[model samples]
Target chain A: MEIASFLIVFFMVRYIRTSLQTAVRFPEWERILVIVQYAASGLLAADVFLDSSITKWLWHLLLLGMVGAAYLLKDFRPVRNVWLAVGPYILVSLFKDIAKLIDSDFYESISTVVEIAEIFTLVWLIATWVSTQRQQKALEKERLKRLQEEEQSRIIAGQNVMLEQLVAERTAELTRQKEELEQTLTELKATQDQLIQREKMASLGELTAGIAHEIQNPLNFVNNFSEVSVELIEELKEERRREDRDIELEEELLTDLTQNLQKITHHGKRADSIVKGMLQHSRTSTPQREPTDLNNLADEYLRLAYHGLRASDKSFNATLIMDFDEHLGKVSVVPQDMGRVLLNLFTNAFYATEQKRKTGLAGYQPTVQVSTKRLSDEQIEIRVRDNGCGIPKTVLTKIYQPFFTTKPTGQGTGLGLSLSYDIVTKGHGGELTVETEEGEFTEFIIQLPT
Target chain B: MKVLVVDDETDVQILFEQRFRREIRAGELIFAFAHSGEKALAYLNEHPSEYVLILSDINMPGMSGLELLRLIKTTYPAPPPVVMMITAYGDSESHDQAMQLGADAFLTKPLDFNNLKEKLKSAL
Candidate 1:
């Protein structure tokens, strides 16, 4: 429809050339080309109406070529010259047609001009319609292709987002699985530790029972011998009191009596004490819990523990500083269990400092400091500190874990600290914490609720 | 009073028997012995509460002393004999569990005879 309107306007300007040019003021060459295109169209119309195959075909071809040339030509002057050349050819044809009959020629001329104009209008309309259809088809195809491309890209981008989300979900699931596995491993480790502790107890119980049994015999002999010596001493006393004593005999008997009594008592008491201590050590008695004074308990173990270490290593001259808070009150605890915990701490401190000395770490003298304080009305805090090669930060977490140890295998069952931790935390509902700096010092702090 | 000493180790039985030899002669103490929980149960079934005290080790191969104590406390409620649970480990859990199971006292290995004597004298 738009093309037909444009063609109609173009024909209007061509037919009323002089007046339209005067109104629109177009360039002279442009007006001349418009006039020649109109004339060629008119000639093709006349030929079509007259049924002149050669002229109509040739004229149609010529019109198309002229339109193509208009677009192709670089300069308007060449087109203007060609139209000016064709103007003279038309006049010559008009003049050469004088031999024709006047009456028939007049009708032919009128009819031919009218028919040509009608034919030109109709043919131009068909051409305009066909070109417009082709353009519309091309535009529609382009629009469909653009829409298809857009939809394809949308699907691809959606798939990419889905893939990324799936990957994230899978990663989160894997992380959750890993966490569960870690928790299970930790629980299994705890169970293993308990079993190991039970095993240690069994062995120690058996060993202690055997030792106590063996030592009881010697203790009985000492006690019996001591009783005989006391009886002999009484006999000597009775003789001395009843008779006038011979000086040499009396002196010798007195000396024998005193010396033998001393020997008997010395061996007797020594054996008795050893048997007693061994008996205490061998008994697999269950813990008896009571409200216990933590400070006093700490002081007691501080002496025994230090002395025990000293007995084992006479060269261990580490100074043990006891800083006990006398005002600290009682904690609900199993005294024996608490004693063992304290023993473990002091021994560990002593051994750690001793190790430092053995390694000649920084050439510093070893020291184990035990301190206790009343943290609050409800809590008591005890710290066992040693100037030793501190555990590495990496190993600190596992220090209280059973079977994790840096000491030589013989030196550690790896259950000392672990058992102590369990005793403090699980047994007494307390807390045990360690603070350490590698190559400097380590401190085990215990907090018990009063 | 007759006392049953249950332990896996022969040395334990010997020590117990020896320690109470004078009392046994005076008719003040009597002794029955079992090396394991099964044997101890068999003896108890035949002679119920003939012994007043049950002393057993906690870490036995089968039917630990705690288990035996539990059984005796639950099944033999009438004149249920006093039970002293003995363990070398001395963890809180065993102590608490034993007490909850109606044990008279809990004793750790390396037993102080005086302490045991006091506990037994009180319980018996």
Candidate 2:
């Protein structure tokens, strides 16, 4: 039992030291308590050899002091309970010592009861110490979990920063691409406008030759008729001043003067219309579409083209047949561009007939016919047909190709049909098609969607 | 004496009739008009030797005044009518070409009618 008590005191020393390390602040005092417990254990071992009453008394008193020292460590409930387990044992031993001195018989019975009580208190102290250890372990696990959670949050913060940077870079690149695309579209539109302008200027060059020639006649008539009218006025004045005024001759002179003035007025109007036509032909084209009367447009251009050809080549004559749909109301088109297309087609038709005329085909009257028709509610078609030297089958397919011309050098730019094709097909979303026979006739048709 | 005026402008006929009214009315000068070189040639075909002098415009639709001059001077029968080339072009090029084509005179428009009358009188 004493050995068992010594082993329990040894375990108590270790358990109290660990448990008290957390609860107690005084290290030197805890050291002293540990020494005291060790001394108590030694004394319990000494009791097996020592037979003297004084020695027995000394061992028990030292054991009693060790338990009393543990009471100072009240932070541990088990240490506090150690006093309960050992108290009566110490008292019973002290009484037994006194009984030995006085020679009494009651000591054995009382010691047994105190010893059992001491064992019960020891069991309760050990249970409390074990439970305290489990509590400390749970606290250690909670601290470790908190450390791992902080590390994960730190890593997440770093990833979020990188993700935001990536998004910013991608957004900047997309913005750059959008800006580049807008710039390219602007450049492309500018280039398209330039090409159309160039083609317009080229056709204007063709019209200039005829204009110079045609303008001469009206101007000549205006001058000559007015000059002759001035002479008639001088004659009428002479007749009025005569002694016997010739009324019949004076009236005839006045009538001739009136006729000459009318001719002057007629020629002046002709000049005005020619200048207006030239202005319209040379007008810069706007890219936007607007409402336009197709019949009026065709008629105006056909006259210009014919007069132009007449002025340049006096022998070039054609029977112009216009079959315009009177009910063909205003259609949406880029007026300048569409006008250019019509002029190009008219100039070509006239050229074709003139070529056949030059061949001196007997009884061949050069004829060019332009007709417009409304095919449906959504579509309109214009056909320019010529009974002249038609497109040879070999060169027919290549007519729309840029820089291709069957006409003599310095006469055709070869851009006319190609540009006209582009204006009809791409600009207006229409189709340009040609029907031809080698030496019979050629007809160009323009189909448009309303 | 009869003079034929060959030009593409029909107005030339009216102008000549009015401008030379005194001479025409007196029958001292007779004027005939043809609107084109082709018509002038046709007129000549009908009356080959009646016309004493011809006044022609250089630029006409069929058979230019220069070509007509060439035909009249070379192809037509003897006693050709006097051919004067009147044109809007005063350029030395057409003048030289007309002269080469045997044009009796080259005149520029707007015609100096007074100068034309003097030249016409001299040619006749």
Candidate 3:
């Protein structure tokens, strides 16, 4: 019986130690249960060797305590296996011990039944533990799969946001570029307009220059012949006085010839002035500035331009109004160039009023007003205004552009205002601007630096 | 004194002759006419040292008055005839160029005969 108890104690210790290490169940309780089992086995061995009922009772109590502890803490999943395996063994042993204590006759049969039940309980506990381990491994694999899927979705979301931002940026850049292109197009159009105007003016200038050159030679001959005739008349008069052969009729005839010669000289000078005006208009010579009386210059051109138009159209007439600033003295300017500018403005003003008169509007009086005033110590202003068929608003801005004209095809070259603009602004460092309203009035303002 | 007038215009000869008719009648002055610079040069070659004054126009079809003036000033014999240049253009550039080419006087066209007569009287 001593050897048997030692063998049972040795096997129990080895089984509890192995289960505590290898099984995925009952870690804390298994440690406590191992202590209790060793105590019980020691007590049982001591009882069998010394024939002590106290030691036997102690062993049974320890086994009962272990079973009760396992039952009480059975909700702990790892401890559940310990409770399931040990609870049946403890109950069966208690029953067999109690049966032996109460009635010795049925103890052997009861021991046999308890042993079979304990074996069956141990097998069921092991199978339950194996299935629980397999289920836990599957749960761990499912959690890992879910984590990987979450990471993939997060990366995709980030990429989607980045792509959206890139698209938005590209759209903004395209819009900015479109605005820049529109601005450049507007600037190019303005430049092209300017270039076309310059080209037209250049060609017109060339044509007029050729015409002026051809007219000069014949005009010079007219002036020279008239002058020489006047001189010859004087010589003939001197001869008559020296010879004392002045018969009253011959003297009268000679006097009449002199008057006729004077008349010729006068008309010849008039034609010469017209030819010179044309030449000055056509020539692109460098400006020669000199101190000139602005009042005299303006008044002279006003009359010249008026008579010139009258010569062309005898029916056309307009009242000329002059308000010259007597206080404004000589201003340094290229007289020929400034004269051209004034002549052009005066002609346009007369033409406008004449056209208004030709409309035969009753109670309508055509008037052209030329006024000059000293604006400051360093500047002068000249304004030419006409109460006539004024400039239309549609063509106001384009008036200074060469080849822009309101007159019929052959009547106007369209370069008068453009040339005047160049003369005032470019040649003299002055400003030329126009103010006009349709069918009412037009005014050209010239501001020249002294 | 003999005066040579060189010009391309034929009418210039008639005008000069009419203006100086009294002087020509009195035998105080004589006139010679050449239609071009080349003709004037040929005349001078034949009648060397005969002309007291030579009046030439600056602009001509061939051998401009300035070129003729240059040749006359440099190649003529000592006591050369006084050469005067005239032009329709009165610009300072032409005046300066003619003066620099050794022209005795520069005059502009629609000539003042009184001034020319005075200059000629003083020169003689």
Best by DockQ: 2
For model 1, residues A402-449, the per-residue Cα lDDT tens digits are 777787865666777887898899888899999999878999999988
Q: Local distance difference test, per candidate?
A: 0.65, 0.79, 0.71
Put down candidate 2 lDDT per residue, A1-450, tens digits, no spaces: 455456556665665677567336657757776776768666775666775555566656566656766776455555566565456555655555676567545655566665566565556556655676687688768868888888888888888899899999999999999899999999977976676677677788777766776677788889889888878888888888999998999988988988999999989987887676677767774456888888877876776687677656554567778999977778899876788899999999999988888888888877889999988898999999999899998898899998799889978878899999999999999999999986789899999888
Of the true contacts between chains A and B, what fraction does model 2 have? 0.40
The residue-level lDDT of candidate 1 at A266 comes to 61
Lowest summed-lDDT stretch of 10 residues in model 3 chain A? A206-215
lDDT of 3 by residue, A280-345 (tens): 544555647889888877875776666455434434556678899988889998877787778778
Runs of candidate 3 with Cα error greater than 4 angstroms are A1-327, A333-344, A363-365, A391-440, B1-124
In lDDT terms, how accurate is model 1?
0.65
Cand. 1 TM to true fold: 0.39
Q: Candidate 2 falls in which docking quality class?
A: acceptable
lDDT of 3 by residue, B1-124 (tens): 9999998766577567656767886887899999888899999989999997999987654466887898899988878899999876566777898999889999987688889999999998
Interface RMSD of 3: 16.1
Q: For each of the candidates, what fraction of the native contacts does it recover?
A: 0.00, 0.40, 0.08
DockQ, each predicted model? 0.01, 0.24, 0.04
Alpha-carbon deviation at A148 in model 2, angstroms: 31
Candidate 3 residue A372 Cα shift, in angstroms, is 2.6
